[model samples]
Target: MVKQERAARTRRALIQAAAEVFAEVGFVPASLGAISKRAGVSNGALHFHFASKAMLAEAIETEAAETVRRLTEAARARHGDSLQAVVDATHDLMGTLAKDIVVRGGFELAGDIARRTKSPLRKEWQRWIEDSLRRAGHSGELADQVPWADAARVIVAATVGLAVLGVKDATWLSRQNVTRFWELLLPRLTGRRDTGTLVSAGSRPPAAVPAPARSPRTPPAH
Candidate 1:
């Protein structure tokens, strides 16, 4: 049992270290030695946990996906207002992207055309947005003129763009930035009555917005 716990801890450390390295340098340039060293584990230990850099990157993506899944689920469960749920999720997503190393690395990997791995993180987010908007439309929460698909597309594009732009300027992921986006967009997307009730900045602030996840060039994580 002790050995199992220790192994799990080692794997977690390796994943975290790999995320840091991947975020600092693109996946193509990241080195196993650096990951192992940053993890404070021997090369052999890293090898025991992962066969190659690709495997480590996959682990990071998997962890990041789970984090987003939980985040979205919690957001949906927290708010009865479907639009509010999306607003809350976006705020949390940006929060995590700015604060979680695994998420940052995963998104970086997803955008790397050099890396052939297909990441589901963006798709998952888009699907959730689509579902939320669809629900809002059915419930009369959306404007009669607003098509859920179109709203989903716009939200996806804007969020993805923000994540990409945030790679150079983290300010793009700030809560205020997201709030401003919603402020402008919510009025157009929500029903007249709902618009008055929906908080464009999200129904609630995240519990805490941690320090930057990386030293520099922070983007929203996948």
Candidate 2:
């Protein structure tokens, strides 16, 4: 049991280290030795956990997909307006991409021409956007002029482009940048009256809320 627990910890550490290295440098150039060094694990330990760097990258992508899944699910649940939820999901996704090296690495890996396959992260995100837009159109949230297919393309392309750009400059993933994106699109996507209700930026997870203020208690008057 103890061995199993330690193996899990080592595997997690190696994955995180590989993510950091991959996010800094492309996968082709990232070395397993560097990952092991960063992970504070020996070469043998790394090999035991992951046979090769490609295996490590696959693990990173899996973990990143799981995180994105949670983001999509929670955003969908709390949002009464499907379009707004998609918009909010973009905000949350960019925030996660900015802070989580694993997610950033996964996205970068998906874009690698050598990989040849669609990224699970990209596909999952695209699926949610399409589903949400379809729901919005069905429920009359989308504006009369808004085309759901074109809207989905714009949303997916813009966010992917932003995520790619963010690889070089994290500012592209900032709340302000994401807000500007929504600011440009919301007017055309939703009725003007509904625009005021949707959050344009920094909409955190449904569970994220500002903490209440604490003040010193006053002594009771005797």
Instruction: Point to the candidate with the largest TM-score.
Output: 1
Local lDDT at 77 for model 1 = 85
Cα displacement (Å) at residue 108, model 1: 1.0
lDDT of each: 0.81, 0.79
RMSD (CA, Å), candidate 2 to true, equals 9.6
TM-score between model 2 and native: 0.88
The C-alpha stretches of model 2 lying farther than 4 A from their native spots are: 191-193, 202-222
- Segments in model 1 whose C-alpha atoms lie over 4 Å from true places: 208-222
Q: In candidate 2, how many Å is residue 120 off? A: 0.8
TM-score result, candidate 1: 0.89
**How do all models score by TM-score?**
0.89, 0.88
Candidate 2, residues 1-222, lDDT tens digits: the string is 866656767777787788889888888899999998888878888888789888998988888887888888877777854666787788888888887777898898878777676678888888888888888888888899888878888999999999989987999988888899899888888867578877787455424322122222221111
Cα deviation of 43, candidate 1, in Å: 1.2
lDDT of model 1, residue 40: 80
